[model samples]
Target: MENWFSLLQKNVLNQQSWTTREQLRLAIVYWIEARYHRRRRQRRLGKLTPIEFETIMKDPACLAA
Candidate 1:
């Protein structure tokens, strides 16, 4: 969590200015979804990215819920 915050601080907070709270929120979400989540690998997921792991495990039955 600390590492994530540090990344956010460096990449988002320090690099840009936001005119509104909503804009800041959206920027954070974009960075998380587009960059961090897509790129980072996890040991629990057998070193695959979350996106890759999800692709491998995706099932219509599971998604329908």
Candidate 2:
């Protein structure tokens, strides 16, 4: 969780290194998709894509209460 947030923050908040916004966007998207999303499926997410599993778990109706 900590690592996930760090990756997002790094990509979103820091864009000065790239000369163009398109370059930065592409780089960030690639990193998120390839590094965090893919690795999460392989290890922590039971092979489900991050967005699919998150959509289910994020719903208020799915709460454990």
Candidate 3:
């Protein structure tokens, strides 16, 4: 959790100047959901992103699906 926050701070927060509280909240959520969660591969998921792992588990017929 510390690493995740550190990455968020360095990559997202440090790179921008948010004007409002809502904007900052949305930016954090976007970084976590759209970028980090979808891009970071996990060893527990066989070196796949959470999205990839879910797709594989949902449809065993084709990995490309």
Candidate 4:
């Protein structure tokens, strides 16, 4: 949780200026959704996105272990 906050601080808080509270909220949501969540690779999927993992696993010839 601390690291996540640090990331937000470095990437969002320290980088830009907002004219309104609503704008700031929207910017944070955009960064988290578009840049952070979608792009971040997880170890559990062997660095693949969830969609990529699902596509590979969807192959009919692949056996589940």
lDDT of 3 at 51: 91
lDDT of 3: 0.89
Deviation in Å, model 2, residue 65 alpha carbon:
43
Residue runs of model 1 more than 4 Å from their true location after superposition: 51-65
Root-mean-square deviation of every model: 4.4, 9.0, 3.6, 4.5
Cα-based lDDT for every prediction: 0.90, 0.71, 0.89, 0.84
Candidate 1 per-residue lDDT, tens place, 12-44, comes to 889878999999999999999899988899899
Model 2 deviation from native, Cα RMSD in Å:
9.0
Candidate whose lDDT is highest: 1
Best by TM-score, which number? 1
Show model 4 residue runs off by greater than 4 Å. Answer: 42-47, 54-65
User: By summed lDDT, which 10 consecutive residues of candidate 1 come out lowest?
Assistant: 56-65
Superposed model 3: Cα runs more than 4 Å off: 42-47, 54-65
**Top-down lDDT ranking:** 1, 3, 4, 2
Backbone clash pairs for candidate 2 read none
- For candidate 4, lDDT tens digit of each residue in 10-50? 98988878899998899899999888877677789999877
| C-alpha lDDT of residue 16 in model 2 | 57
The deviation in Å at residue 15 for candidate 1 is: 1.1
Quote the RMSD, in angstroms, for model 3. 3.6
TM-score of each: 0.71, 0.44, 0.67, 0.64
Candidate 3 has its poorest 10 consecutive residues by lDDT at 56-65
lDDT tens per residue, model 3, 1-65: 89988999998899979999999999999888899989899999999999988887888766556
